[model samples]
Target: MKISYLLILLSLTLGTPSQIDVSEVRTAYIKASGDEQAVEQLNSKLISVTTTDDKVLVAYKGAVGTMMAKYAKGLKDKKSLFKEGVSLLDYAVTSDSLNVEIRCIRLSVQENAPKITGYKKNIDDDKAFILKNYNSMTDEGAKKFVKGYALRSKVFNDNERQLFQGL
Candidate 1:
């Protein structure tokens, strides 16, 4: 009985040696879209994951960059932030071209950005890709995040929402 109890306790503590999970990290990031406080929290998390994969880091930075771009106070500040964010975003996507979650982040940013910014090119393709492979995602939180997004945003049409059914 003592040995069984010890084993269970060890799993609770050491089973999750890595502090961050990709799905959780990605979800926290998307939730931080316009909130400055959330963005700051995200930056803190991003910094602590030095040993994490480059793709995940890139995606987190891209999300943080977008938030900074949207909230930076001055025109010059905003422009600079936009440059940084877009650079990170491109780098992340290039590094992991087939990552559906990263593409979802880009889609969310572009769909809501001002029309004059010319960042709306991939909405259709991303929607198609996300829908095509969404069911295969192993992370339940990630699935819920995408489904929540599709339900709340103007990015998807009625027909598209139907496709995202039971997500």
Candidate 2:
């Protein structure tokens, strides 16, 4: 009961300006388990997910839409499923710059180990952008955003180097 209340409070208080699909957010949030790492990831993702269909949002959007679309296609299609998962991961990271777990999850999304090398550049780009801009954010209400960003950078740097190396 206490956990449920906490989750609700977190969701209500942290909601972004864009209309968040509450049900979808809840579905994603519950997967966090009691693990601090997963919770951190979910917290980041909440900020990035937006309901507005704007070009800016779409440009920065990752693989979430593709992943959700593919998931809707069912599990029988292995190739599609794998690609979709990767896309979702990309979206998750794109949406929540602070969610570091998405970086870790990206590892399992790629089938070929060699492809990991290719992704290094992208990850490096992300890291540069994050490190460069995060300091500019100063609003007290957005401290959680800053915290999440730092946490993601540390985790991705330490645990998911292949993904972060490209940035």
Best by TM-score: 1
Residue-wise C-alpha lDDT for candidate 2, range 86-144, written one tens digit per residue: 45456656666553334323322222123422443355555555455544545332333
Candidate 1, residues 1-167, lDDT tens digits: the string is 99999988965654332555677676777678678888877766665333235665666666677677777899899878777776777777777778777777777877876776687888888888888888888767667777777777787888878877855
Report lDDT per candidate: 0.72, 0.42
TM-score versus the correct structure, for each prediction: 0.76, 0.35
Go through the candidates in order and give the C-alpha RMSD of each one to the true structure. 7.8, 10.9
Candidate 1 Cα outliers beyond 4 Å, as residue runs: 1-18, 48-52
Q: Best by lDDT, which number?
A: 1
The lowest-lDDT stretch of 10 consecutive residues in candidate 1 is 47-56
Q: Judge candidate 1 at residue 84 and give its lDDT.
A: 72
Q: What is the lDDT of candidate 1?
A: 0.72
